[model samples]
Target: MEPHAPAGRLAARAHLLAAAGRPEEGLPLLAAASGTTPAQHWAGVPWVADPTLGPRIEPGLLARTVMRLCTAVGDPAPATTVTSLRPYLTVVRHAVDAHGEHAMLLGAGSALARRLGEVRLAVEWAGRGARAQPSKLGEIWLGYAYRSAGRMPEALAALRRAVAYDPDDLSVYADVAATLADLGRLDEALRWTELALERDPDFDCVVHTAHRLRHRADGDVEHLVALADFVRDHPDDAHEHTDLEECCRNAAWLGGLPSGTPLPAGRAPVNAQPSADALHRLQRVSGPAWPHPPGAYDRALGLVLVEPWELLALLAHPETARAEQQDGLEVWACLGLLHHGTDEPWLDSSRRRLLLGLLDGEVDRVTQAALFAMVAYAWVDPEAREDVAAVVAARLTETASGANARAVAELALAAPGLDRPTRELAAATIRVPAAPRQRGRGRSLLRWRRD
Candidate 1:
């Protein structure tokens, strides 16, 4: 393997090209060579050689390269080709075994294994990593691997070791709080969260986790309000916005709120009250679960409506989350923007890009329907709405059924910003003779009695 350049240099080159925004040129190269080539391999005879220095590449170099390639290739995509890299794990582990301190290799292997759903392998690898190097990030990852495997006791012990190693790391505290909550020990989790909060109340991770633990465990309105206020004030924290969305969503869905919980002292978003009131007025009769819609759990904060973050999450999933009782949610949400009245504070440049992404990408039928339904909103930029209508109109040529989708298309045409082709397509969709009713009531996506 060492006679020439690196063994899998071709595959590495291909992946780099793919990562450099040339997937069409690079994917085929990667696919062809990835399975057969090993980027680095055991070159020397194994019979009597030392295990640590056994691989052709150094452990540190291998670790850094693997981590970088993983990022370049992107997880969960090019999955088939990436699996070929698995053989390098043996080399990584062997080197770490002799050194007993290859933190990067430990992290890379553990992360790769975890993402691949090799839970047992992750735990085994993480345990070995920590055993070899207890005072580093190895211990922290060992805790995570244990938590992933649902081994809470072992996870707790590993996290405690991490705490001992780095007493001031707020992340360790957050991890402990999460693991404790998973074990149904919210009381203990609350205490840990409080400790983290004492160190830095403004730290979004600790504060959000604390509020989540306390609110979900106790159904207390105060913590709920606090969480809401945090989201309101810190929606775009430089580092933690994405993390906050995921964490708060998990806290909301997995941990139900009490419908009867008293309102807290404050609210952040003044706009969501109507949706909250509508939700309450039309509250479903499900048992004690007090089910909250995704992104709509913090009703006490006056911001319980589905939000932009929720939309992003939905679109990211392989299959969008569904409600058997309701119309297509993505469709409704696109339509709901009609009421935004030409000036959406949330529809900033980033949001414009997100919506444009929805239009340009290969979305599902429901999402396509959303693009069609969004045409009527007089509020949206005319050019953007035109783009949406053009896509929908082009698609309607293939899937257009005049009767069922007519109401939506008719509704869409009634608004401005449509070109002639879009208008003609919209007319073709409505086989059920157009009956123009009052326009204000039915255009919104929210289907409450208040609609």
Candidate 2:
């Protein structure tokens, strides 16, 4: 590549640095390129010139470069960096109009808009791209943008259009299934999830969704069987540890295993250790906030929070668990909140301490009780249960100003295995009624019994 060739020096340097595992060093060059006019940036590139002169640029090179820079910056490029890409988006738009609707430019613009927290702009650009090209890729972006914006109906429609355009895209199938599941159409979601698995059974997200969908759709135990089978058959697969751990959790919840029972054979042991890299990846993905739209962020957060327990469960050695506890507590507390009505037998004293700390933080009292209730029902120790219940009851009283808070408190109290005193305290706060039993068809039976 010539020193002065279009994107030559910059792209070459960036590629070399990236190949050397020093991609961060190339950011300055990318940043400089971002500031240049699009035409100037492409000036010496062979493709932008008349073909007779030299080799042309590859079809998607420019767009790919921008995407590469964005990715290199981080999973989510800094908001400031994303904001800085606006000029480039303008250039892409100009190129689209000048070149009679280039799909790449439109798509890139859509992505840029989304990254910059401009969902409406993303929708507009993606829609234009789909209209221009009528391709599955364009439609996929349109659907994704719509979903990110919380426009679920439009998102579903666009995703369906993408499916019509290309039934073979397993990612689209997974997205469609997830969207349907979010809308409470679990049966339809299960069908799409199965289709996704049929296309690519090895994809972790697809498999995860299929299992979740099956559980939701009909309380089927098939997903557990499939997970066990996968673990037995593919022990060396990269995802084996996580998958097996999840299988154990589902087994406990769905199969009614008692607390502390050994998982079935071929399952990873509760003490199975996770690598440092895996833990780091989890924290990065599930950290305090996401760059996505709020609804999407909440959904992603809920999934991430609920998932780490299996991994946490596997780190059973007390010292190891303690060392990792701080890094994982946020996830656990969030999980407690999400699993409000569900029992999690994994909560121990250390984990409970982590949760108790959250109460002293900025979180609302009622939300804190709800989270505590999740942990409370899981406590096997009497003292721990009392402590958790006391916290819940106190928070319930403190938040007595809202019916919502009281309702949440009642739900927490309804969790099985509370002591009588805690139950009485809850009863004092809310109307606790007797458990009703159905009467037999017994007017004649009562008369006969009397006789």
Q: Write the per-residue lDDT of candidate 2 for residues 1-451, one digit (tens) a residue.
A: 2334445466567556646755444433543454332223422322222222111222255456555444434423455565445444544444555553667656766776676677888888788888888988888788878887889888899999998988876767877897898788888888988777777888666776676667556533334445544544554654323332433342322211112322111111243454555454444433222211111123334433433344333222223334534332333334433333224443444344434543432223223332533432333233344555556655555644443343434534433344556555555555643233222221111010101
Q: Which stretches of candidate 2 lie over 4 Å from their true place?
A: 1-59, 70-81, 84-87, 212-451
Question: Each model's TM-score?
Answer: 0.46, 0.42
Residue 26 shift from truth in candidate 1, angstroms = 13
Q: What is each predicted model's overall lDDT from 0 to 1?
A: 0.49, 0.49
The digit string of per-residue lDDT tens for model 1 on 1-451 reads: 1233343565566557645754334433433343344233222223213243324345666565555544543433244544455544445556556555666677667765665567798788788777776664888778878887889999998998998989888878988998898888888998998898889887777777787777567543335434545666776754443333443343322222212221111111112233333323222321222112223222212212444444333323213222442223343343333323335443354434444445442224333434433432222233454555455566455435532344445334433445666666666666455433322211222211211
- Stretches off by above 4 angstroms in model 1 are 1-54, 66-103, 220-232, 235-326, 329-339, 342-451
RMSD of candidate 1 to the truth, in angstroms, is 18.3
How does candidate 1 fare on TM-score? Answer: 0.46
Q: How far in Å is the alpha carbon of 370 misplaced in model 1?
A: 17
Model 1, residue 28: distance off in Å is 19
Provide the lowest-lDDT 10-residue window in model 2. 442-451
Q: Give candidate 2's error at residue 60 in angstroms.
A: 3.9
